[model samples]
Target: MVEAALFDLGGVIVVGPWEGFATYERENGLPEGLIRRINSTDSDTNAWARMERGEIGLEEFAAAFEGEALALGYRVDGMAVLNGLSGELRPEVAEAVRRCSERLKTGLLTNNYSPMASSERSAELAEVMGWFDVVVESSVLGVRKPDPAFYTMACEALDVAPSACVFLDDLGVNLKPARAMGMTTIKVVDPDEALAELEAVVGFSLRG
Candidate 1:
């Protein structure tokens, strides 16, 4: 039986900021996915990875990211990409998380940097964080997704074996390691569909 449900924050719980990126791209006349390209190149050692791992601050990341972009022959605005990181919460996901916490160990595993200031967190987000039994952040942990250590830390925190957990994440890359470790992985494209898949795995209704 699944003993825990692990969720990703940016894409799984809240609306992903892809639309923001799209808008920024259109406004800047940059080619579509220019930011994504820079992020993916040398992904593990890139500015983004460093920031998420808490090895660099936002301003340092922006400078390093600009250098990476220039190396790729694009004059990308790293700060603009960071500005587009805001995502709206999905109420349905919050409801599902609340329900999951009632029945199983629930965790939020996210590759995110620490908030530069306390004001970065809102009341709604604080409430959502309460629904999770454990919240594992890459910046705090010094390790991020796709790193087996990250998954292991979450599993250990929940006191569940990988085979006894289900993890939901938006990126297949992030899900790959967890799946390999024997967790049932759901790649979340549509929130409803992902919740349905979770329901099937955990034998519970997640949607209202």
Candidate 2:
């Protein structure tokens, strides 16, 4: 039985990187897949990986990422790429979070920048985040998703076994480790579909 529901903040809770990437591509006339390539690269040495871990600052990340993209035959604005990390909250997802909180332990397991760096988008998102019983931020923890320890820490913080928690994330790569550790994983592609899947897993109605 699932006692806790773990969620990813960016793609799972809000419109994120990909949406920003689309906007950047359109504005710059650059080839698509620039941000994708940057994020999908080797996690250990990639600029995005470093930034998300709080190992590097935003200014350094912008320059480092821009340099990498330049070698790939296009130039992208680093700040523009960074801007895609935050997005508007989905109302339905917010409602689902409150619903989940009523019956289960909910956690926010997000690979994000440091709290000092990421500004609150609005009162809504800040409040939605507050609904989670535990928030495991990668920047604060010095670890990013796909790292096994990150998953372990989230479970520990929530005080639930991996098997008793359902983890939701937009990235398949991030979900792999959780699945390996005996947690049920949900890939959140569309808001409605993902929430429906969550309802089925935890045997509760999140639609309210």
- Which residue ranges in model 1 land beyond 4 Å of their true spot? 115-119
List candidate 2 segments past 4 Å from native.
116-118
lDDT for 30 (candidate 1): 85
| lDDT, candidate 2, 1-208, per-residue tens | 9999898888878876788887888888976776787667776778888888989999999999998888787878898777666677888988888888989999988887776236645888878877899888878889989899998998888899999999989999999999999999999998899999999998988886
Q: Which pairs, if any, clash in model 2?
A: none
**RMSD after CA superposition, every candidate:** 1.4, 1.5
- Candidate 1: 10-residue stretch with minimal lDDT: 113-122
Distance from true location, Cα of 103 in model 1, Å: 0.5
- Let me know the TM-score candidate 1 reaches against the reference structure: 0.96
Clashing pairs in 1: none
TM-scores, all models, native as reference: 0.96, 0.95
CA lDDT scores, all candidates in order? 0.89, 0.86
